[model samples]
Target: MIRLGHGYDIHRLDSRENAGQPIVIAGVRFDGSPGHAPDFELGCVAHSDGDVIYHSVVDAILGALTMPDIGCLFPDNDPRLRGADSSIFMEEAYKRMVARDYRIGNCDVTLICQKPKVNVENDAGESVKQLMRENLSRLLHTPIECLNVKARTHEKVDSVGECRAIECHVVLTLERTA
Candidate 1:
């Protein structure tokens, strides 16, 4: 049997937390500097590294397999998860799926943000794809081609439109291989 799951997430911009650091979305880091800050000045805040891409992906996989969410498995209330690396979370989710004899068919992600330039050349989608593919491949014991990632801009109209925040949506398909 096969199941499909979709997940989405958004985080507000924090100039204080990420004042001079590069904005990392979906594991891809965007260079942020004065007059050249990757096109957006805002970022998300959380107990962990705040990688929306990884978080959404984790939720999508868990939801597809009727498993616990990232927070439920790695609660924010736990000090061990503070400033935690998202890759670990992804690995753990994949492990849970494996324990249940489920295999990942494919995963897709869309990132929506307003600034730091919407152009692909500056948005860092490729980097994100590479990282996700690598991590997912390791966890699922599959090839990297099974994962896809896309990014879009909100047209600078609303909160995301103004680059005040970033949003990510993830979809995953899982099959019971055993």
Candidate 2:
């Protein structure tokens, strides 16, 4: 059997955490500096690390399994979850996916942001999209070849395009291994 899931998440980049607070996407940090830096003067207004990539992936995994989403399983109201690392949420989702006997056949992610382009390499000489693919593949135990990440801009038409927010959309196919 095959199952398909789709997930989307968006978060504001201001009015909460100040800029230069570190904008973590997928698992990489784009921080420091001011106008010269990517995601300059922007920070996600979220209780967790505000990694839209991971959050969307988790939601996709849960949706494919017909289970509760990230919000339900990890409520934002919980004080313990404040400043939580999003990878923990992703690991739990992966565990659930495995428990249900499903493995990723293909995972595609589209990251929308006006700043801090996802195509550029970080200070560590790692390409953002490749790093994200690697991270997701590692977390889900799927071959890196099975995953693809694409970067996009909102065309200066919305909040994401304005650099006030970041958004991500994920679609994945789960195939039964047994």
Candidate 3:
């Protein structure tokens, strides 16, 4: 059997003063770019680590399996889940997928943000994307070639474009392994 699912998530960017924690996306922390003005100090605001990419991928897997979403499984109100790592959410979804005899066939994700360019000049951007692909493939137990990631700026149109938020969209294809 085969199934397809799509998921989307967004979080508002917070100033360092307002955000009690650092920004984490796709399990990678945003440690401020040295090239940015006086060091980059932007981050997402959320109850958890605010990894929009990871969360979206989890939702996609759950959607493919016709299961409850992250919110349903880990409510924001739950104190135990406060500051929880997003990878835990992904692992939980993976357990469900394995139990259902399903494995990821392919995954494509897009990130929408303005300020933090996906890749700066030189090999920095490419390196980041490669690292992300490797990590995501390992997390999903899928071949690196089966994962695709793209980033785009919102062109200063909305919150994302204005550098006030980050958003991610994921599409997943799952195939039964049994």
- Give the per-residue lDDT of model 1 (tens digit) for 26-131: 5555554322224444555667777778889889888988777777888988998877778788788778888888887888878787664433443333443465
For residues 1-178, write the lDDT of model 2, one tens digit per residue: 9999998999888743574257788876666333222444467878888899999999998999999889999999999988898999989998888889988889999889987777876555556677777778788888998988888888998788888889999999999979
CA lDDT, every prediction?
A: 0.71, 0.83, 0.82
List the candidates ranked by lDDT, beginning with the highest.
2, 3, 1
Error of 1 at 162 (Å): 1.3
Best by lDDT: 2
Q: Which digits, one per residue and each the tens of the lDDT, describe model 3 over residues 85-172?
A: 8989988998899999999999999988886665543124335666667778878888999998898889899989988899999998
Error of 2 at 157 (Å): 0.9
TM-score of each: 0.80, 0.91, 0.91
Where does candidate 3 have its weakest 10-residue lDDT segment?
Answer: 31-40
Q: Is candidate 1 or candidate 3 better by lDDT?
A: 3
